[model samples]
Target chain A: MNVTTVFINALAAVCLVFALIKDTTKTKQALKIAIISFFRIFPTVLAIIIIIGLLSGFVPESQISKIVGENAGFRGVLTVAFLGAILHIPSLISFPLAASLLEKGASITSVAVFITTLTMIGMVTLPLEIRILGKKLALLRNGLSFIIAIIIGLIIGVIL
Target chain B: MKKMSKEKQKKGLVKDMLFLGIILAIAIILLLIFPEKKELVISSSKGFFMEMILILPAVMILMGLFAVFVPNDVIVKYLGRSSGIKGIFLAILMGAFPTGPLYVAFPIAAALLKKGARISNIIAFLSAWACIKIPQELVELQFLGLKFMITRLLLTILFVIVMGIVIEQIVLLSEKTTKHEQTS
Candidate 1:
């Protein structure tokens, strides 16, 4: 295993051990919590991953590259920003996808917008977020995130 | 209070279903519009299924475990206002620790906010760590040039800090307005 994986495993082990040592009841509670969290989040993650994979397969890299190329300009920036807002691919998938897009002649601006929006804006997770945080807070957070993503993309476009 | 909680829960369930339906419709449309070239379908299906199998279990278990183990008090203590720079520092630290996807982070972040984490800090914690994980950065730096990686990292940190402060102010103003409305 890589150093990162080893370190993560060690950390998880340490936490588990610490919880166990502290109290048997707490340990049981933690396990239950973990199980519940897993069930709640698993289906959504699975569905998202499948959709992203399908998207990558279906969309031609050439077409994606053309629309988001450096020359695509302001329109490209807006497209990247909006696409980022709408698509909720995990970072794990996004980095590779961005790299592929870059290879296909996509501009750094588009990639930057994609990365920024990949985390900040989330169309797929909007309902879940609204349920948890309420509509006002959810809308505010997402709205601000979308706006900031465009700004970041523009800055990156100019500087990098 | 009980009645209010029940009403909210009922509303939330409906919203969740609506959202799921929308996503499914979109997915179906995409699939139809881009019917896979037969040659590529096999490879794509294999990749898609493999990723689903691997990620689903891992993400679920991690989210559940994190939700249970990391208490509100601990999150608040580290990300809370009174914690100051130390809190921000700790928030960064926690963000560095590997977790599930961004969606999982949302529920936890919301929970932290309810428990008194500043909105700005939560935004910072989510955005910075969510996008530029340290471990991921290590791998990316090797391929993407360290200069690019470092520049991105530094800028993202700055962005998170500024955004956090802005969000906190917005939240505070909203809270005050709500309080005024309640009293009036």
Candidate 2:
């Protein structure tokens, strides 16, 4: 396993042991929750895996770069920002895909925007958000997230 | 309410599985048609799968531990009791942990709202939960390098806070105007 994987697993193991020692019942509850989440998240994770395969296979890195590269400008940044908001992949998985995109020549702005919007605004989860948080707060949070995503992208593009 | 959510969760799960199946079918078809792309697709997918397999369990465990140990009520109680600058920071700090997903945060945000937490802190908390996750940052640092990860992290934090305040102000203003109109 890679360093990140090792570190994460070690951390989880440590936490689990400590939790078990502190409270067996709570630790069992944690395990149950983990298993449930793993099942619930499995399908999406697999879908993302396949999508990543298609993305890298069908579209050449050069083409991806053309769309989101340094030359793609503000429009490119906006495109990725919107794409991120619409797509519902877990943010952790997005990191490697984003890193590959960067290596392929996608601009800092587009990458940053994609990550920001992908994490912040969830178009797929909007109904749930509205149901729980009310229409006003839900709409405002998402709407403003989209705007701030672009702004954050632009600033990162400049600084980095 | 719990039953309704469980039903909804099942529906969502089925939909996701269907989507995965369709994507898998398309991928297989594409590979069959374009034999040249087979190796590229297989190798790339395998690489990502390996990467994900290693860390995903750990991430899930962290999420579970937080979900069980911390509990939503605790979050609402703490966030609700605090306000101003301290509350904002606390929200952000609390949010930075592995607290499941943004969708999960919605209900907590609603609870905070009911508990009379400031709109700005709720917004901040949500934003932080969405992007500033600790496990996510570790993954980002692994893939994107220290410089890229740190820069984006700082930038996102700054902007999210600003966005939180801005959204809160605008929302409050609109609410005031609407209330005035009603009174008039």
Winner by lDDT? 2
Give the per-residue Cα lDDT of candidate 2 at B135: 73
Assess every candidate by TM-score: 0.61, 0.91
**Candidate 2 residue lDDT tens string, B1-184:** 8899899889989999999999999998999999999998888888878887787888888878877788777788799999888888999988887477788788788888888898889999999999999878877877777788899888887887887788889878988888643110
Distance from true location, Cα of A2 in model 2, Å: 2.9
Cα shift from native, residue A9, model 2 (Å): 1.6
Once fitted onto the true fold, the runs of candidate 2 whose alpha carbons sit more than 4 angstroms away are A131-134, B180-184
Candidate 2 C-alpha lDDT tens digits along A1-160: 7776778889989999999999999989889988898889888878888878788889887898889998887788889988999998878779878876786689988998999999999999998898888787889899989998898888888988
Candidate 1, A46-159: lDDT as tens digits: 455444455456677777766999778788888888888887555644654565567557887778778778767778878877777767667877787777777776777678
Clash pairs, candidate 2, are none
lDDT of 1 by residue, B1-184 (tens): 7698558656755654566567667666776776754335335545545534443333333444555566545655566554577666567667655455566577667767776776666777777557656534643443344565676677666776777778778778987888653111
Cα distance off (Å), candidate 2, residue A25: 1.0
State each candidate's clash count.
4, 0
- Could you report the DockQ of all the candidates, in the order they appear? 0.30, 0.63
C-alpha lDDT score of every prediction, in listed order:
0.63, 0.85
Return the clash pairs for model 1, or none: A34-B64, A34-B65, A38-B60, B120-B164
